[model samples]
Target: MNVETQKVKIFMQKHDNQKRALISILQDIQAEFNYLPKEALQDVAKTLEIPLIHIIGVATFYRSFSLEPRGKHQATVCTGTACHVRGGPKILDEFERKLGVEAGHTTEDRQFTLETVACLGCCAIGPVVVVDNEYFAHTSIREVGSILKKYRKKEKDNE
Candidate 1:
């Protein structure tokens, strides 16, 4: 088996290949690859004896799962009512400008993927930006560059 298939099989084994553990298996696969790869999904369906359509349905049902490859870092801006009213749109715009990629897209360098969430559930901290799950409350347009820089610097240091 290929590396991907092997890895997916391990995930399935971890859940004892239970059909009911579909979501959990997918989560494991996503955690490994940062996204649900097509091959991995196929392997899952075949091994679990589940229909491919059903697998796809479950995969697409969750906003957290991405069929396409994501970036090394995920950057999400909250755009719910409170955030919107607090200049969330402008903050998103600033991120798009700085990253040179629109929301819902990954940068050409594959360093970051920019996304927008309806609400982060922290109305008091309107206009929140989360990178790799690190919440930046009360974010502003001026803070966009620094945020990106912080992640980029981490990448450089790791290299």
Candidate 2:
């Protein structure tokens, strides 16, 4: 079997007989695979006896769910009022400068997906960045490199 099939199999076992856990189950499955591949969603619908439209509906309704390809690392910069006043735009510029990708785009290497979110509710930690769901609060210009270091893979050309 292919790697994708194996992933679907593994995810299926995690569900509670595929009845009521579609949202959470699919969420977890999406977390594992980066994005919900069409085949994976179809497999889920087929196995759960849920319609494909139903699956799409659930997936699209939730902002956390991404239906397209996502990078290995997800970086969400806060663009709320507090963050904006606290040099959030500069921080975003630095990210785009360093990563070669703007918000809502992925790095060419597929190592990072950059996005902006509104109000993470940690206003005190203005200019916050959440990477792979782990919030890095009270951010500054110098810290961006250190955060990127944690997620970037070693490239052969560099080695």
* Per-residue lDDT of 14 in model 1: 96
User: Model 1, 55-99: lDDT tens per residue?
Assistant: 999998898899988999999999999999999999999999999
lDDT of 2 by residue, 30-144 (tens): 8788888888888888888888999999898887788878887789989899999998889999999999998988888887999998898999978899998898988998999
TM-scores, all candidates, are 0.94, 0.77
What lDDT score belongs to each candidate, Candidate 1 first?
0.93, 0.85
TM-score of 1: 0.94
Poorly placed runs, candidate 2 (over 4 Å) = 1-3, 13-16, 133-137, 141-146, 149-159
Candidate 1: where are CA atoms >4 Å away? Answer: none
Q: Which ten residues in a row have the lowest lDDT in candidate 1?
A: 119-128
